[model samples]
Target: MKQTRISVLAVFLVLAMATAALAATEVRMVGDALVYGSFFSNRNFTGWNAPAWTSATPTWSKAGKKTEEAFEIWERFRLRTDFVANEAVKFRLEMKVEDTWGHGTFTAANPEVAIMIYGAYLQFKLPCTDVDVTAGLQNVALPQSKMFYGSPVFGDRMAALVVKAPLIDKTLSVMAGYGRLIDTNRTYDTTTTQVADELDAYFLALPITLDGFKATPWGAVAVAGKDANLFTLKSSQQNSSFYADNLTSAGTYATPKLWKNDQNAFWWAGGAFEVSALDPVKFYADVIYGAGAESDRKKSHRSGWFMDAGVEYTGWDVLTPKAYGWWSTGEDGSTANGSERMPMIRPNWGPGNSFLFDDSQELVKNSNMGMSPVGSWGLGVTLDDVSFVQKLTHRLTFLFVNGTNSARAIRTLNTLMGSNPYFQMGRDLTINEHVYGVNFDNKYMIYENLSAVVETGWAHGEFQQSVWGHSLVNQSRNGDTWKVSFGLSYKF
Candidate 1:
């Protein structure tokens, strides 16, 4: 049962690291490493094959496929380590190295390379009361407001059993965790491959901070023991060659899984703040309210919600000025369970909060979006600590998008080749097309821990309807997409 529930906490953290190597309060060890290299370029291509809006010729390709180009080259690396044994024990281990920008060597004929375990936590401090107990495979964030737990799009490690207490002053803190998003190892399919575990959660949160501004009231849940009880949500790292799944009739292929029924057992509750009466002109407003999921019509009830408000003007630390708006609540995905859609349990935004659309855009830089997503406003600034360069920092954004055909939130391509093939999977071949973008990013700290990033954007898709009238019968079109990115961030 999950390795006997973490093997007695890994044998009590190796017996407290052998009593901290013979007590002396010295046994300390620290290390850190992170490297990020990226490059992504794109140009004119309507969400993968543009041109379509016909039935009487009002123009465009209507499925003729035109104007396309793309590129990608990314590299990421991480190697962290910490193992103190003093002032209240500690231990962490992160590793994800084994990279080679474009591969040329470093081939020990398969001396093994993939050794991932994002983190191996174990922090301590709980003998009489100051409570603080963390256990293995960690990295779970949620003070909400990334549109329901985000960061690298919920790609932030999770394998919990954590607790930290201090509620009622001492800065008011509280956290409770739990995990095991899914489990299935029927030893190789011991009969129809059943035997599922699921688990998944975040029992509660409370990081209050009255006047200092920093509120975090949270709650999350998910359960589904046994596969048939259903609860997929997949996409938790299963590259499968960057999204696969298209071979049924017994061939079976699909797996980025964003939804799987068995209904009711998903929850969300939120409150993330940082307003402090608008200090240097900064304000934030986060809102959330969710209710289960597991409906494909037939008696619907997978409720939904999401919101993010914003403002920033940082009293000119180097030119700051911003504005924001966000919303997530749309569905008509017409089954495959998208009706329960709530950003599909969020995470994955950025790229101007997803006008970079897909998972449904909501940008603060980037995120992978699109399940009933919305982004109406976002004006930006912050030119940098410039004057000569004080660890440079530049940002500029402007995006406005209207949701819907975030590619039919997929649902098997909007229920079988969207843009309306049998039904109006959003009528008009799929809708969505009011994008307007512009962004310029910059980050430079070339020294002291090394950092350097560059981002670029240019957009124009306008097409919420217009092919003469009702647009022939939608199939999603409207083009003009541009991008450029470059990065190098290192820390040690």
Candidate 2:
């Protein structure tokens, strides 16, 4: 009886091992974090000139001329797991966390902690077919030589259903995806959070190879619900100044601009090509055009046409050169039906390490994730991947920018910790301000997964905004602004 029991136990062990091997689970984790600080000269402080070139009230601030600087840090972490449940079924789940230091009440009794689901989806092959289907939250990036329409433009994840199938075997591929930008929700705090306020988008792409070159033509369309845009919607990051008008949210010091109840349609079609058919003398280009309209929702006639083109030549690793130009129709300040300036954001390819220094953020538009290149157009040239020493590489870029729609310049400037409104707007501004800038970027690889970088940027120009500080003719122009930053980052 004892020998029989031992044989049974061995059989059970063998079965357990076989099941484990068949499961074929794989897990991986990769993350990166950055800690950096910058010193700003003439960044937060201008020579005033608020009341124009005069003696008293000449500068905007009471302290006359000023300068400010500070340091900041941020991090990003990701985890991914994949497993084969069966012969023809596979699944993957990815999670991510990204935030700058001091996001919320860190010392509070219940600190706010947020972790986003970056990618959580299921994948499987169709029975008796060479097609694949993926459903759930996913990562989607459009084709681009630059970052023209690549990656999640606004946020991290796309809750979508996607399908991919080969049309001509390995020569041509087609893909389609549909997703919801904002889910229809009924919030506990607001009764007006209706289903009709949700936003949805769709994407279609065809990537094909001809000889040694590849081409990708893609199209996308997004629909915004009534009063569902960033300006109209009130969230932690944006407000319509409705409360500021009544001295509530951020008090009366906040800039006041009423949001229009809008239903907007945005669409774009573009193509990218990689001319690698010529080996070391390869060339690349990306061209795009997009039009947006809000119809009669706002009664202001909001519409715009935007375009961008770029070319690059990577003949050598140490001295690649690239250039690009963009144009977007501007607004005429006409109160006809709506705004005419483009409402969508352009991919901000900064003159430097965009994280450390960027004109689009410091000069025109800024967002929580970094900088936004929208409502503006310009040209730029860059020298990339200059490496003369081991483990060190350098890059430099020069740029010129002008507002596309309005005289879009910053009005109020304050210290890093100063209590002033971070961004204040002036109604009577021009799209005439132009900026010429240069950037220097140096990167040093310390280890296989670690790096250190230094970056500097300088911009010399100014915008004239005359509708602030209780004055109708108070025009201001800040002279020169520069930033220097150093950072350390680790990835695995």
Candidate 3:
């Protein structure tokens, strides 16, 4: 027994020495915590995700199974730690925890433990060179205007190896990387010896900066296997991968079928530019074109163009006003020629702090109500940082959008796929449909690292019966959408 105790002590001593050595390296941490409560009415505005109309429920419900107003409180926390050995090398690790207040089996006494790894990567410069390399799981976003936050085609986190090299001192640089989005063979069934269904993407960008202007031209291509997992899943308005489903040329949603080709290719090219030569007057813009999956059936192919621009005036002391506009090619009358909507891996684009689109939000689980800027166009005006009180600020915005999809095309899809939750009447609008909204957001600082936030919005949808049919129109007529959220955020 004494010998065993001695061995255990030796193990502990070794571990302590290792931990002390690691502490010698510089370590830093940054994180944020958020808690929020939300109350929303008529979130389903029209057809998508709403419960069926019946005597039991008069108003629109947020989900098919629920017949009540959507209300919930959620919380989340994120922490990122960096271990730096020198100016040229560092390792990053990020983790997160999030959940609804009381919906799950989690309780005060028996809490569920769920900690997710958000990022883990190593960043280092090459020896005797100016080149920088980042390898491992990390955030990836194609080049796009800063005003839009990130690329509309693809923006998310994935495992990748990226390299950046300087070419002309401070004038130009290049970035390139490769990412694997899906590997079904390993993800689902590793024992089977069948062909691997994989999806991989490659990206390249050239960033140029001058005295008063900056621009980035980027391109990306992806290869997908015939049995990629993205095609097998049920289509949903919440998931962008539904765009990969084989849509019939006649605008009908069909069951997943085998494709003629063993492999498919998707590509995108775009450029983003910012002009600040006028100082207080600045301009930002991005243009992108994408196409995907050329198979024997035209239904499997999709292609389109998207562009957005914004102008901001920062000369005012109390506020900065901005105007933004966007446009994209929409679906035509026929599905056989393929959809005119741009294909996206994952989109994280939005202008201003509009609640109608999936813009990043300060509160947890309070946004992304199935509105995306894929086949639509809109305009918005924002008064940002309007402050009259100390430690407090407010923002006001007005935004409107009009659908570009042909009315006939929408009618055809609804007639055949009306029961499919993926085809929402108001959320997926026709050329004759439109929506408008206004938002009032406020923030008050309690401390340097803590703040209280409140956001409220109202939206109205106009869906023509001639295009959406009587049933859909009736469901959509419940009322305008309204939402209010209050939250507290702490950063360190």
Candidate 3 stretches with Cα past 4 Å from truth are: 1-21, 46-65, 187-193, 231-258, 466-472
Is candidate 2 or 3 superior in lDDT? 3
Residue-level error in angstroms, candidate 3, position 9: 21
What TM-score against the true fold does each predicted structure earn? 0.28, 0.69, 0.87
Model 1 shows how many backbone clashes? Answer: 33
Winner by TM-score:
3
Task: Tell me the whole-model lDDT of each prediction, alpha carbons only.
Answer: 0.47, 0.51, 0.74
lDDT ranking from best candidate downward? 3, 2, 1
| Residue-wise C-alpha lDDT for candidate 2, range 239-259, written one tens digit per residue | 211111111111112222222
Indicate the worst ten consecutive residues by lDDT in candidate 2. Answer: 243-252
lDDT of 1 by residue, 367-425 (tens): 12122232132333224233346778666667565554334343444333333211121
Give the winner by lDDT: 1 or 2.
2
The residue pairs found clashing in candidate 3 are 249-335, 249-336
Scored against the true structure, residue 401 in model 2 reaches a CA lDDT of 69
